[model samples]
Target: MKRQRNRGRVTLASIAAMCAVAALPGQAHAADDPAPYAFDPEAATVRGTETNAEASELKSGSVYRSAIKPGQKLYYRLNLDDDTNAYVSAVAVPPSGGKVAYGDGITVSIRDVDDTQCGSEDAIFGSGEFARPIAAYAHRVIEKGNSTCREAGEYNVLIERKSNATSSPDEWDLELRYASEPAVKAADAQETEAPENWSSASPVPPSGGQKRSGGSSFYEATGLETGEWHDTIVPGQTRFYRVPVDWGQQIFATAALSNNPKSTEYLGNALSLSLDNPVQGHVDDTTLSYSGEPASVALDPLPPVDYRNRFASASDVSAMRFAGWYYLSVTLSPEVAKSYGDEAIQLRLKVNVRNDPKASPYEGAAGIFGVSDEDKDMAKSGQSAPQAAQSDTMKLVAAAGIGAGAVLVLGLGAWTLLARRRTAPAAVPAAAGGQQPPYGGPTRTW
Candidate 1:
């Protein structure tokens, strides 16, 4: 029988609900088909930003879904401290089959309230980036005695469309994620630079996803079991996949993101690799500029997961501290945008899930908010005890507490080629809980 999964059609409310489900403890499934997928955290409907909002008015760390007309502009205000590192990610979800010639040009910039340009990037969706959505990301670190955007009280994140040829009249979704990373202290700075002890799991899981075509979306993540997985992705796109790791298992993943050899252009090493855990947001992430070469992300096995209080790590890797379906997300920077014309770039993943004695395994009966209640009780008693069997709700809650699926049909008009289901499956959902784990909610500066 075909495995049943969430048809991943999502709304912000659904995402919020899924985020709630993510907080619940896991329940066991009785050898049933795979539950339908989860909701999308980034798919929130946004308020108007066609005009710049004040720093106090603009929200941070949450995905704001909005749209602008051609030649229009959107502005967001940011307030920062000297010790805070600011991050801004702009996602442009293109319409199906829009004939974009020069690409829907996007210009994003950062400026202090006095209008000093701190940073700027022109992200043009080239005709070559036809299959998937694109994103524009910018970052700034407030430093001591910095000349530009110094002692930032408020800054502006500006986004503008440089062309109107390809986009539809309906406002396309413009989702932005703004965050502040804590700066390293002088005492700990040296220790922070220490290299990680990379380890590999023997006999990786023997499952892989189907070959990625030009049209895969983040929603329809190919399911990957532990093992070596392979696929190709377009530059200027981020792809998502799901791997179910139970309570006692440790997960490890590595990816080799390489440039297209046929192209003679300079491809910047703009490859981004990371992992998102079940409850916590991005746990670990790294960006390597690919100036036409290859780069890799080698993720180590997470500390054994327990549904209770989690041990903290980096934003991208810490979320995996729990046992559940973890998301392995890969996004390509557009340095290769000009080099590869509609050609998919290649990627290989080495995924390993192993049993760990140190971590609490999901094999036990689930408890409150994803914390097995029995574990909580054991912690209280200072001894392990027997618990009842897990119910069906545990399975439902573990799978983002989603309902069943329905047929999602595409319009048969001019965009038939773009509406192919053979394209990307719908994306899995995560409540990008503000910053990272050890924090239950998303870290928006509201």
Candidate 2:
């Protein structure tokens, strides 16, 4: 609620995941747990909805500020060169209060300029514990695959507000982004480093940023450094943060959900934490759900980078051939949000970025949003580019792993990971002199 907004459960996949994570070296002075996250409001959003052009032409590598009215839809056209893949995303702000049905929330899809559907996907939500004042993200990818709508041309992306929305339609803010990935080199597609996934989340100096109340949107994500971060989320809501995972540094993170009986009862498998690579691809996702116990997901650290790497794998962290601002996504479904205490669910997010921070691979390139210019050129080739290669085969996909009671299921192929277990992430010792996070706030008397 502080910085712009700022801000888990486990499901069945925890059981299927092997918990053999190697312990990180013991910390001497570093706090293992994340202190409350700090907040900073950066970059005013540029609105793109003033002109409701369904075919408003958009460049392939850019982020747009846009909004939609009730039952209204906004469209942007992207011109893609043959052999290149396209990645696009839309983040929508959730209105506060009321029952939000999962089936009719947000839908994003790609089509030709004339409106023939190339491919489309709907967005879904988990239960929530509160009335809702959060945000959700929807993404779609048009790869250079041999599919129906993958060829070069002007493609339109539609951001639609379904008639099924229970709350009155308000002007919703949307952050839209699209990246064009060039083709990859044949040699790089075969070049990959498969080291044993590192398991240590050793304590370190707290990175910058003071605790912020709400970072529930792309425009409001709390800025995260190399240390652990702390925030709270209501069910049916999703919180997003921007992490500076510089090139050459490997980043490891975990989400620890409070296990109070009242909280745990409705939280079974409702927790999920995911890492989105620089281009917003859902590469590494860890999910768990349980009816009677606390839940956590230990995301293996991402390895350092090089241009010679394949972009596809069970874990997308290591698949990064280049580096920029990677987004960290945490979600608690609507069903889970409904039962969370009125105050919201408390969470300790442990993040460890090994190696020092450096400039992003795309920092000085053509773009400023971290979608590198070099990557876009390589996208034309289709194999060497990280986002482009995946574009050929996968759409911008969302991961889902739902838990029933204590049962764990690996139902979502794109969202599942071959995770080995480590102890719950909160095991880190607190930094010296730091105090437990304050749970009370200023009294509001009318």
Candidate number achieving the greatest TM-score relative to the actual structure? 2
Encode model 2's per-residue lDDT on 75-118: one tens digit a residue: 67677765555667665544544444544456677776566675
TM-score of each candidate?
A: 0.43, 0.50
Query: Given candidate 2, what's the lDDT at residue 171?
Result: 66
lDDT measured at residue 120 in model 2 versus the true structure, 0 to 100: 50
Cα lDDT tens digits, model 1, 167-278, are 4554555656665443333543323221234343444434554442211323344445556666676655566665556655666777776655665565444566656554
Q: Model 1: runs farther than 4 Å from truth?
A: 1-44, 53-56, 164-170, 188-226, 230-239, 242-446
> What lDDT is reached at residue 90 by model 1?
64
Name the weakest run of 10 consecutive residues (lDDT summed) in model 1. Answer: 381-390
Per-candidate Cα RMSD to the true structure, in Å, reads 22.9, 25.5
Please give the lDDT score at residue 140 for candidate 2.
34
